[model samples]
Target: MKLKRARRSRRGRIEIIPMIDVMFFLLATYLLASLSMQRLDALPIALPDGKTAPLPSAAPLTLSIDRQDHIEVGGHAVALADVGNAVRQQLHDDRKVIVAADDKATQGTVTRAMLAAQNAGARALLIVIRHEG
Candidate 1:
């Protein structure tokens, strides 16, 4: 018989532990980044629900109150006394006015505007809110 052929023990494939370690490291990194970006939002307001028909898209009169409590309509500053007369003349019949009040403004100011709009014979008075944005 010929000389016995030399045979070496076979080596199996190595387990991929480094791949699992990399996957876990990537997961941790994403989790930490996502947590850092988390932020709180403002309180929610509930809108009324009903099966109402849509209103026409008429251009609404916008009234805004600044931090100093000054009132402006259509980007023009006007005296509080003249608001009703002015709105009455400008608005057409069957249209409502929009009052946009800032957080710094008092409730009375907004209420006064609404009351004025109503007194001027506005069909409806709507209070515009920041939530609309």
Candidate 2:
């Protein structure tokens, strides 16, 4: 009896289970990371109602924070550490410091700068805001 040759099969189909699992794991990781991030501060702000009194000093020493997060005093960019000294020096007799911060400016910068101005002996701290237009 002649020996029958066994039929040789080609390469078996590749399993996609591992690839699918990897994709799923990566998707889950990204979703979790995205969900874990905390949103920016949106604290409640109440505007003054009724008759508003004028500031003690009409003209105030201006500390501006642009969108780029640069600190400027009296139209001059000043370092964060030097803000207090600069403000004080600029306003020898003045008692008010007005903070004009862009909406895109970092909150920490504005807050810290304000504190610095106060520490530098600003009699009044006025918070000013501008419209996008």
lDDT of 2: 0.75
Instruction: Estimate, for each residue in 38-58, the C-alpha lDDT of model 1 and write its tens digit.
Output: 742212222323343444697
Per-residue lDDT for 38-132 in model 2, tens only? 54322223222334345564567778777677888887778899999998888747688877777677789888999999998898887764323
Against the reference, the lDDT scores of all candidates come to 0.66, 0.75
- Which has the greatest TM-score? 2
Taking all chains together, each candidate's TM-score versus the true structure is 0.52, 0.54
Stretches of model 2 off by over 4 angstroms after superposition = 1-57, 131-133
The runs of at least 3 residues in candidate 1 whose Cα sits more than 4 Å from the true structure, single-residue gaps closed, are: 1-56
